[model samples]
Target: MSNEHITTGQAPKPVGLYPHARRVGNLLFLSGVGPRVAGSGPNDSAVPGLVLDHNGNFKEFDFEAQVHSVFQNVKAILEASGSKWENLVDVTVFLVNMKRDFHTFNRIYAAYFKDNQPCRTTVEVNALPTPIAIELKCIAVIE
Candidate 1:
C-alpha cells in the first residue's frame, strides 16, 4: 500500500520537516506532538503557561498545561489523518522530567483516555526538541 502524509492547521506546526502524521493502509502513525500552540514556531511563546528568559531558562512553567496541549495536538493529528481519538491503539509519551511531572501527567492522561484506553508507554528523557515538558507519539486505526 501507499503512505499518506497528513497535516492540519488545528495543531502546532512540527518542529522539523515532517508531516503531522503518516498513514499506511488503516494505520495512522503520528509524529511526536508537542504542546506548543497552533501557528507557533518551535521557539517563541507558543508553549502554554511557560515563559523563558533570553537565555532559554524557565521563568515560569506549568506541566499541566503542556500535558493537556499535547493531548489536543495528538487529537488534531488523528482527526486530520482520517482517524479519531477513540481509534487510538498505542501511545508513547516522552517526558522531560518524570519525577517532577509523572503524577500530574498521569492524572490528566486518565481523564482524557478514560474511555478509549489505548496501550501506553511513558519514558523520561533528557529533553525535548523544544521547551515543552511533554510530547506524544501515537498510532490509530482509520477504521
Candidate 2:
C-alpha cells in the first residue's frame, strides 16, 4: 500500500514539520489537531475565544469555543482526506485540564457524535504545544 501525507488550507496549519494527516491504504490518521483558526500561527491569539497577554498569560479563555473549534478542525481534516465525520473509527482527545473541561467537552462532543458514535478516549495533559485548550487525534476509514 502507498502512504500519503495530507495537508489542507481549510484546517489550521500544522505547527511543525508535519502534515495534517497520513493515509495508508484506506486508513486516514490525523495528527494532533488544535483549535487555532486556519491561517493562524501557533503563538497567535487567533484561537477561538482565547486571548493571551504579551507574557503569554491568559487574558481570556473559553473552553466551549475551543471544544467547538477543535471539532471543526477535525472535520475539516477528515473531509480533506477523502473521509467525512461519520467515517471516523476512533478518536483520542487531549485536554489541558480534565476536571475543568471534561463536562463541557462531553456535552459538546455528544452533540457532534450523536449519529456517528466512534470509539473515543479523552485524557488530560499539562499542556499542548499551542495556546488552545483541546486537541484531537483521529483515525478514519476512507471508502
lDDT of 2 by residue, 31-130 (tens): 9999999767665678998888888899999999998888899999999889999999999999999999999999999999999999999999998998
Q: Estimate each model's TM-score.
A: 0.96, 0.96
User: Which window of ten consecutive residues has the lowest lDDT sum in model 1?
Assistant: 38-47
Candidate 2 is scored at a TM of 0.96
Alpha-carbon deviation at 69 in model 1, angstroms: 0.6
| Per-residue accuracy of model 1 over 75-106 as CA lDDT, tens digit each | 87887778899999999999999899999989
Identify the runs in model 2 with alpha carbons over 4 angstroms from their true place: none
| Best by the lDDT measure | 2
For residue 104, give model 2's deviation from the true position in Å. Answer: 0.3
